[model samples]
Target chain A: MSSQSVVFKPEISKPLLQEVMDRSGQNVLACYQCRRCAAGCPVGDETGVTPDRLIRMILLGEKNEAFNNLLVWKCVACYTCGTRCPNNIQTARINEILKQMSKEAHIEPLNPKVAAFHNAFLTSASHFGRVNELEFMSLYEIQNTRSELKRGGGWRAIVDKIKDRAKLGISMMKKKRLHFKLDKIKGLSEIKRLYAKAREKSVDR
Target chain B: MEIAYYPGCSLHASSELYDIQSRMVFRRMGVELKEIEDWNCCGATSAGKTDDFLAIALPARNLGIADASGLAEIVIPCSSCYSRMIVSQKKLADDPGLKNTINAELIKKAEGKIKISSILEVLVSKANSGEIAEKSIKNLEGIKPACYYGCLLTRFPCDVEIPDSVENPQGMEIVCKIIGAQPIDWSYKTDCCGASAVINDTDTSLLLMSRILHDAVARGANCFVTTCPMCQLNMDAYQEQVGEKYGIQKRLPVYFITELLGIAMGFSPNEMQLDRHFIDPFGLLTELKLI
Candidate 1:
């Protein structure tokens, strides 16, 4: 790794760091440039931003760099870096906060599929009080197709993907790994209420 | 002999083999798994990544239901579910004020403590007591498994520790030993499989999975077994893709820890749907004379 000299902007650091800390409850300021987290992160190499670097960006108030990075979207949330950190600074939690901030700021996600998958998971969970795998996958595929079409992706390619995935889905069903039933938990309204409260809290933030 | 069961969505859907084997093994041991009525998803990594309340409240609802039903303990077979449940529980234990605020916001009550156990933890616990050994009927001597703990089972959220060693866990191996299967030591046991990415960003998932599968093969493991549905999905279903993407040709069958335990309890492979995996495990079992 190479080091670069850059101006530290404390003026820009306050709001981002303050909100991130308040949101995640992680001590981002406690990071001492110990690259232990960097050494352990599985995607740091490919993403070009490690956990330590992400924390440093917040500490230095590089809002642009921190918000618009691949690591934020690509992080597996494996808790490996958190497990290795001496200060217990979990980058996964920090990434989650940045995701909320980015979405609020209207920054288009660098990875749409991951974003769509998370959205599908939440939507399925909120509706059914649990994830209906059949419903979730369908929702995810619709978003995926919409994004593909938006990117000027080929209809032929999209159809080909659908055909391939359909084969796999059918095979899994045959093996009894999948079901064709629509199901929900008994306390459905309670789950819906929780979702409503969470949405209101996020809007307030 | 009776306890709560939280068969998370993956268990109820994609990883039915794990769910079925868990029930079969536990039933043979005389431990009844009563699923908490109307249990909800714990939101896995998705909820926490977007909404803090969804992450906390979802798992808390199930924990609250278990407590209300007078069940003090629950078994979660999925590693992701276990992590979410235990992480939420730890938060309540660590901060009473925050717990009170969360409890008040929950439409359902979440005021009581609940113990969560991974199926690996349950299997190892039973193995430690020689119960698994006593129930064994098959001669499964030569079957060797690379005991993959994946990311969450051993290395839980920090400060929330399970009894197994974090860096190098032996809980699965402990169960394997009693059932006459050989469990191999391998690197990457606790490494991330880039699990969720296997859905959205498959190239990265393939790379991470190949690393784990290759390491297990190099370390002389004939097969792989884990309790995590997410990990099993990557390790088993994607073995062909992993091989094609990484130039690793070895195809090792992966099973849930409960599958091996069930076979030792004299359950047929067909009964456990062991052949349903992309990399069918029956060939390895047959070669080892385990069938």
Candidate 2:
């Protein structure tokens, strides 16, 4: 028994692990402490929490830690972890579930810009059956700037952001990459129904 | 034959060059691309992260359109849209209950009979048939390209079948080879470019992209060829920023796979809209005397 590392199974609360498993459809229990996911994660060093460690948090019923990690916000859904995992456990899906859980749990998002951009994207997708790139980016800019202001970011920061984005936008426009003409989808009512259905179903959860 | 084409949001504007070059090149290869009638966004990484049902329902709506149109197959250029479409296509096909639940809100009901193809897969098949090789007016023997697949081109849900090796993709290489371009086999072929976070988390995205660029450039790749609009934009539009952060002086041009194929097919830089890229995709071509 002394020859191998031992796992001290702390008294585990069933809710956190069960909820994540249910929502994400990933078998977090299948993780055997192999750090294959850790080595492959592009942002693991930056996030300070690798896929294996995050799974350990869930299995250990560390609800707050599971929902609040930077991995939950910064994961780009690269699928590298799932590709390399021996058990095929996808942390990207788990991160998505945790992001929603954090929002519902009233834990402030560690990365508000991601949240704001997501909201802007959905709002644009809902407004018109398709995403108007011009509308969505403008929406993201407004919400992101406001959030930064709320966080006490100085006007200087906002000005710098505007200058940076303006330069980027102008370059894109010069190349005819910016769509000045809006192209909305024809099935507008159908898209609205889908959004309404999603909201109604999500509330029931 | 007429093939259904789904451009998604990025293709309409930000990746217009890809759209233009694609139309031009496919026409040259004797294939007609008919745009899908008023397709919606696939929700991409944003929609799925925002709502699971929208992720499926959004793409399903388009699949429904294609299937209903009797276009047995549809081709997508963007990797993000292709992955979303194929993954959702597989999920809705396998689970009847989930399909029924999502279908109730749709104007067009998805029958789950349509096949989805990425533009890279389409080109590779054409290259194999000798159609693409026949159109090559100039031998692209001089340029060396790093075929960057990024994330979603070949990686999907575990159950879905991918056309190429997920770890080491050769679809771009296969097509480039047909046109006489030597494609570099690099380590960062499947690396994630921090695509969705390119804007919200700019620093992290740049760091990830820097690693990818570093490896490709180290391997002596002159330019990057990708099928994903997001990957191309991140590397092409923001390589200057990536250079500043990583202190790398070398600026490698990024081009769409279709654009590179267009170059070999005797289309000029202006015809291919090579100037649309921030890094000047034509610079390496002109320097190498390929064009």
Predicted structure with the largest TM-score when compared to the true one: 2
Model 2 chain A weakest 10-residue run by lDDT: A4-13
After superposing candidate 2 on the true structure, give the runs of residues whose Cα lies further than 4 Å from its correct spot.
A1-12
DockQ of 1: 0.67
Residue pairs clashing in model 2 are none
Candidate 2 lDDT, B1-291, residue by residue in tens: 878999988988788788888899999988888898879888999876767778888899998888888887799999989989998888898789989988887777899887799998889899999999898887888678899999888666445688789798798899989988888878999999987998899999999999999998899988888889999888988899999989888888888888878888888888887777788776678776767
DockQ per model, Cα:
0.67, 0.70
True contacts kept of 1: 0.71
TM-score of each: 0.96, 0.96
**Candidate 2 on A77-157: residue-level lDDT in tens?**
888898889998988889888887787667889899999989899899888877888899999999989989988999998
| lDDT per residue (tens digit) for residues A1-205 in model 1 | 9998877777778988898998888989889988998898888878999999999889888888898888998988888888889999888889988988888788878887888899999998988888988999899999999998998999999898889779878877666678667668888877887788788877886
Error of 1 at A191 (Å): 0.5
Worst 10 residues of 1 chain B by lDDT: B105-114
Q: Going through the candidates in order, what fraction of the true interface contacts does each contain? A: 0.71, 0.66
Q: Which candidate gets the maximum lDDT versus the true structure?
A: 2
Residue B52 shift from truth in candidate 1, angstroms: 1.2
